[model samples]
Target: MEDENNLAVLICGAGAAGLTLAIDLARRGVPFRLIEKMDSPFPGSRGKGMQPRTQEVFEDLGIIDRVVAAGGTYPRMREYQSDGTHTEKDIAERDDPTPAEPYHIALMIPQFLTEELMRERLAELGHRVEFGYELVGFEQDEQSVTSRLIGPAGEEFVQSRYLIGADGGRSFVRGALGVNFPGKTLGVRAMVADAALTGLDREVWHQFNNGNMERMLSICPLAGTDLFQIQAVIPLEGEVDLSDEGIMGMIRERCARHDVKVQSVTWASAYSMNARLADRYRIGRVLLVGDAAHIHPPTGGQGLNTSVQDAYNLGWKLAAVLGGAPDHLLDSYESERRPVAEAMLGLAAGLLDAAKRGEMRRGRELRQLDIGYTESPLTLNRPGRWGPLLAGDRAPDAPLRGAAGSFRRLFDLFTGSHWTLVGFEAERNITSGRKGLHIHRVGPGCELQDMAGHFRNAYGLTPGEWVLVRPDGYVAAMVTPDETSILQMFFSEVGLTDADGLRH
Candidate 1:
C-alpha cells in the first residue's frame, strides 16, 4: 500500500518548527520533502507570542514583514511588588553600541500566521507541503533511512540519507528511535483561552487585582483579529480538572469586577507543563528538533523562540553536510544547541518552581544575572564573555559590504553558498593554498562608500577586525588584519578549490 522515492531529506510534520527548517534548507538548494499527518495546519492561535530573537530569525527568513502585518507589537508589561509597583527594566534594548543585529524588542505574531508565511516562502522556492501524510513507520541503516507515510493518498515509502522529526511533543520519531525524552512533568496546571471581550485595556497585560489570587489575569494582543492569549490559574480545589465551566468561571469572575465580559469564545486548552530534553539529537541518520528535542514551561516565553532557533542552527549544517562538507560538521549541531537547550530547561524549571512557591519577585533576577560556563566545551577561545560563540558555534551577525552587493548582514548573502570571506586588505592579500578553501574577492562590483559604511557604522570593523565568516555564518576565527590566520581558517574548515579541485 505504498509508493517509494529516494529523496535527500524527508522531514516529518509541517507546523512552524517543521516548516522553518524546511524553508531554510530548501532555499539553500538542499532537496527535501515535508510530510504532515493533518489534512491542514493545526488550528487556533496556539502559541501567540514571538520573542525579539525570533523576530530577527524571521527577518533572516524574509517573512518578518508578513508576520508584522499579521500581528501587532507586544503590549507594555506591568511589573508588580508587595511594597509598590516597580519599574520593569528594559531588557529588550541592549545598551551595547552595535550597529548590526538591530532587533531589541519582541514581536507579537500568531502561531498560524508564522507557519503560513514560512510555507508560502518555501513554495516560492518551489517546494509544497505534503499534507495529510503521516509517518506510520521508519527503519534506518548505516547508509540511509526509510520512512512509511500514510495519508489521503494512502501509503508511500520515502528513502533518504537523513531524517528529521519536527513532529510535536508526542513525537512518533522520538518513539520510533527509542531515544529517552527523560524529565519531570510537574503538577502545575493553568487554563489558556482565545476569546473576545471588551472593557479590559486589551493591549496591556493586567496582573494581580485587589490582592486576590483568583483575580490574576494575563492577556496578550494578536494582530489580525480581536484575539487575545488569555491565561489564569485553575481555581478548583483538590486536584482540579481543567473543565470548561471551571475555566470560564475563573475568567468571568476576574473580568466581572472590571466590568469586562466575554461575549464569545474561540478555543481553550488546559495542560500542566513538562520540563525535559532529549538525551540525543541524532540517532544514526535521524535527528530531533523543537518539542521533539525539548519541552519546557512557558514562564520565560522561550518555547517557540528556542525551537525556531534550533531549526536555524541545524538547517544550514544539514545543507552544508548534504552538499558534501564532512559529516563531523553535522556532529556540532547537537553539541552547540543541546547545551543551550539544557540551559533553557534549567531556567524554565527555576522560574516555574519559583512562581508556584509564591517567591514571585526573584523570577526577574535572570535579567540582571551574569551567566557564564567555564565548563561548556563549545565555548570559544574567550569563554566568559563569549558563551554564545565556540568551536563550531554560530558567529554573531555583522554588516558586510562587497562588489557582490550591499547586505544588511553577513549572514544574508552567505546563505547561498558554502563559505563567505570578508576582508579589509586588497584582493592581492587573498590566497588559495594546500588545505582546501574557497575565497571570493571583496572589491569591484560594489561601491566603497556603502561597503565602508557597513563596516565602520554597522559593525565595529577596525583595520584588525577583518572577520572570517563561515559558510554557515559562524565566525570561524577572528584575528588582527593578518591574511595568514584569516585565510588559514577557511582552508582548515572549507577547501580552497574550484570545480577543478584545490587551487594553487
Candidate 2:
C-alpha cells in the first residue's frame, strides 16, 4: 500500500537548482519537499565561479551578504611556458562596481560552500532538505503528480501539484520522461580534484603547459580555502586513475617541478565535456531545471549560475500558479529558459574549442549580466516607449532618498516576493492599492528621490512613464501614463485583481 502525502511541489535533487527552488518556495510560504539521493551535501569545488547576475539573484534571496562574505575575487593567471619563461595576467577583465550594478565581477566560491550557505538559509526559513530520499518513479495527471520515492525508511508515494527535476546531467527524472537530450560530446576529458599542496602561490592560478594545450595542467587556488583545485588533461580513450596518489603523480609528472608537492586530496573526479540540451523542458505536470534540462562544458563557468537562475525564474511562476494564477504561467518557464540554455551551450562549446587552441579569454559574456528575456512572451513592450532597459530586462539597482531623509536602494524595495512598480512623474491615482504590488514614485514631490540620478541614468525614464518589475527582478511591462488600461489587463491576466492581491 502507498502512503499518502500531498504537497504543492516535489523537488528532486538537492543541488543548486533544487535548493534554490526550495528556498524560493519556502519564503513564499508554498509547501514543497526537496529530496536528494545523496546522504550528504556535495564536497567538490566544481562550478566554482558565480556570475554577476547570479549574485543579484542571491541578493534578492537575502543571502548575498553571506555569499559575498564566503567568497573572493578571481585571481590572476600565471602561465609557465616551455622555454622556462613565465608570465602573469588576469583570467578575466575586472570591472568597477557601480550604483546600478554592485556585483560587476564573477565571485570565486566553491560549489560546496555555495550549497552549504543556501542550505543554511533554507533551514532558517523553517525547511530542510530530505537527504537519502531518491525519486524512483513518478506519474502525472491533469490535477497532480504521484511520485514514488525510496528513502532510508522505505518506499512512499507522494502526491504533488507539480514535480521538478533538478537532478544532475544524468537525471533519472529526465530519463523517465524520455525527453530527447540531443548534443555531441566535445571529446575533451580531464581529471579534477581538490588537494592541499605546497610551493605554489595562492594569489595566482598556476598553469604549466609545455606549448601544448592538450598537455596542460592547471593548479588553481580555491578562494576562501586552503585547498587548490588541480585540473589535468587526460587521454579520452584511456582509463584515468582517480585515486589521490595517482592524481598527485599526474600533477608531479606534468609540472616536472621538484618544489611543488601534493599533501592530500579531499575530493577527486573524472570529467568529460559534453554540450547537450533537452528537446523539451516540460512534459505535462513535470518539468526540468539546471543540468537536467541542459548540460554545458565547464569552460565558461555558466552551468551552475544558469541552473540557479532557472530555479529563480520557475519559482515565482510555480507560486503564482499554485496561488490561482492561470496554469499557462508555467509554460513561460520553458520558453524563457530553454533558449538561454541553448545559447549557453553554444557559448560554452565555443569557449572549450578556444581553450583547446590556447586562445581562451574570459570576458563580460561569462559574467552573464547581459542575459535578459526581452523576447519572452511575458514581456510587454509599449510601441513608443523608448529606453535602453526594456520590458524583460533586469531591473537595475539605484540609490534612493526617502522623504524623511533615509537612504535606500531600489533593490531594497524589491527584496521580497512581490511585484514592484516604479513610477516616474506618474499620477498618484495609479499608485492606489494593488494586491501583491509595491508602488514607489519618483520625480517632483514624490516620496522617494533619485538623488544621484542613478535611477534616471539606469532606466532612462521619461516623465509620466512607469516600469513594472516582476517577482524575479525582470521588468514585466513598461508603460506611459496613458497606458493604464494595459497595465490593468496585464495584472488581471497574471491573476492579480483589484480586490484580491495574489488570490492566495
Candidate 3:
C-alpha cells in the first residue's frame, strides 16, 4: 500500500506461481503485490513431487536447502504395477549438464512447504501478500495496468506497470485478455490423497492398473513431522465416497495383504485432470504465468513446478524493465518462456497419454528428460534441436568460493539485485557502480566450499573460467575453455544499450 502513482508488477493469486513470482521480483528489488481470492490457506497437501528443475529453482531462490531439509530425498522415482511389478527403470542420475548449481535429482516436497518457504523469503524482502484481495478485473495501457480488486471490505483499484495472472487454471486475467485455454479434459477422474498409513509395501511411488482401474500411489517422506503423505489415484466412473474410510480402504485393498486394518487418515480429496494450454501468454501490458498460462495432468507433478519456473523466467525481466532497465527487456519474457511452456504442455500430454494407456515406463522415462531450453531466442547459438550452447535453462551451480564463509554458493552472488560478473579465479572490474552491474571475484582461496554437497564437479571450478550470471541465475554469458562467446553476446545481447532496448 504505497503510492498509487508508483506501481510495479501487480500479480493475482498468491499460490505457488504467484508467490514465487513475488519473491523473485522482490529479490530483484522490484516492487510487487500478490493477491489471492481466498482468505484462508488450502488445507491438505496439494502438489507433492518437486522436479529436479524446480529444486534448482528453489536453490536460486535461496530456499532449496529449506525444501531439501524439509523433504527427505526419495533417491529414486519408481513406477510399479498394482500387483507390485516394477515397470520403468529407476532414474537416479542427473542429466543434461548445466552450470547451474544443482544438476541433480528431483526433490519431492509438499506443495504447502514450498509455498510457506517462498512466503518466508518474501517476508524477508519486506513484501507481504495481500490475501483475500481478489482481482475482479484489470485494464492496461502502454505504460501501466489498472486492476480492480475485491475483498471483505469491498472493492479497491490497483495500478501497476505490468499485471501477471498467476491465478489458477480458471484465470480471470486470461479471460479479461481474451486468451483461449484450448485442450482436452479427461473423462477419467483421479482421487489424490495425503493421508497417514501403515503400509504393507514401501515404495516412493506406485503406479499400475487393476483390471480396468488405473491408479498412481506416492509415499513422500516429509521432514520435521514423522508423518508421511500417502497419495493414491482412484479411477472415476464409480460411486465412490471420498470419505476417510473409503480412501483408507482403497489404499488398504490396493496394498494390504488382506484383513489389514485402516489407520488414522490425514487428508484426502478427488479431482479430475485436464490438459490445457493458453493460446497466448502475453497481451499488451499484461501477461500470464504459471497455471494462468498453461495447465496439464498432474502425472509428472509439474503444475506447480512449471508455474514457478515461469515466474523465474519472468520475474527478473519484469523487475528490470519496471525498475527502469528497458521496456523491450520485458518483451523477452514472452519470447523465452512461451516456447518452454509449449514444450511442457507437449510433454505433459505425452505423460497423460502414457498413464491412460498404462504405459508407466514410457511416462516415467519421458518425464525424466531434463530437457532445457533447446529452442528459444534466449539460448545462445542453439541449434533448433540440441539446446542452448551455454545451458540456457540450466545455470552452472559450480562450487564457488567467496570471501564471506565456507558455505557460500554460486547462486548467492546472483540472488541479490544485480547482474554479477563472476570471473573464476580472476579479478572482476566494473566500469562504475552506477552502471548497475555487480562484480565479484571467486577463487580457490575463498572461504565458500561445500563440505558434503554433491555439486563438486558440475560447477566445481579450478583456476580460470569467466562467466557472467544474470540476476535471474541464468548464465547471461560464459567463457569456457573450448566454447567462447563470452564477451560480445553477453554484452551485446543481454546487456542494456543506452537506447533502452535489450541488446540481443
What lDDT score belongs to each candidate, Candidate 1 first? 0.64, 0.89, 0.65
| Model 2 alpha-carbon miss at residue 114, Å | 0.3
TM-score of each: 0.81, 0.97, 0.80
Over 413-455, each residue of candidate 3 has an lDDT whose tens digit, in order, gives 6665566665555443422232446666555553344444433
Identify the leading candidate in terms of lDDT.
2
Off by over 4 Å in 2: 1-4, 499-504
Query: lDDT tens digits, residues 1-504, model 2?
Result: 112454899999999999999999999988889999999999999989999999999998989889888989889899998777899888888889999888898899999999999999999999999999999999989999999999999998899999999999999999999999999988888888999989898989998882365788999999989999998888988788877678777877887787888889999999888999999999989999999999998988999999999999999999888888899988999999999999899999988888887778889888778888998988889776777798988899999999899999999999999999999876674745776788889877998998979998899888888889999999898787778877887786676656545332
Q: Which ten residues in a row have the lowest lDDT in candidate 3?
A: 380-389
Clashing pairs in 3: 99-395, 99-396, 99-397, 100-395, 100-396, 100-397, 101-397, 398-459, 399-459, 493-504
Q: Considering lDDT, where higher is better, how would the candidates rank from best to worst?
A: 2, 3, 1
Per-residue lDDT of 195 in model 1: 73
lDDT of 1 by residue, 78-182 (tens): 544546463443323333324454554456677777788788898897888988888999999987898888878688678988899999888999999988999
Supply candidate 1's per-residue lDDT for 90: 30
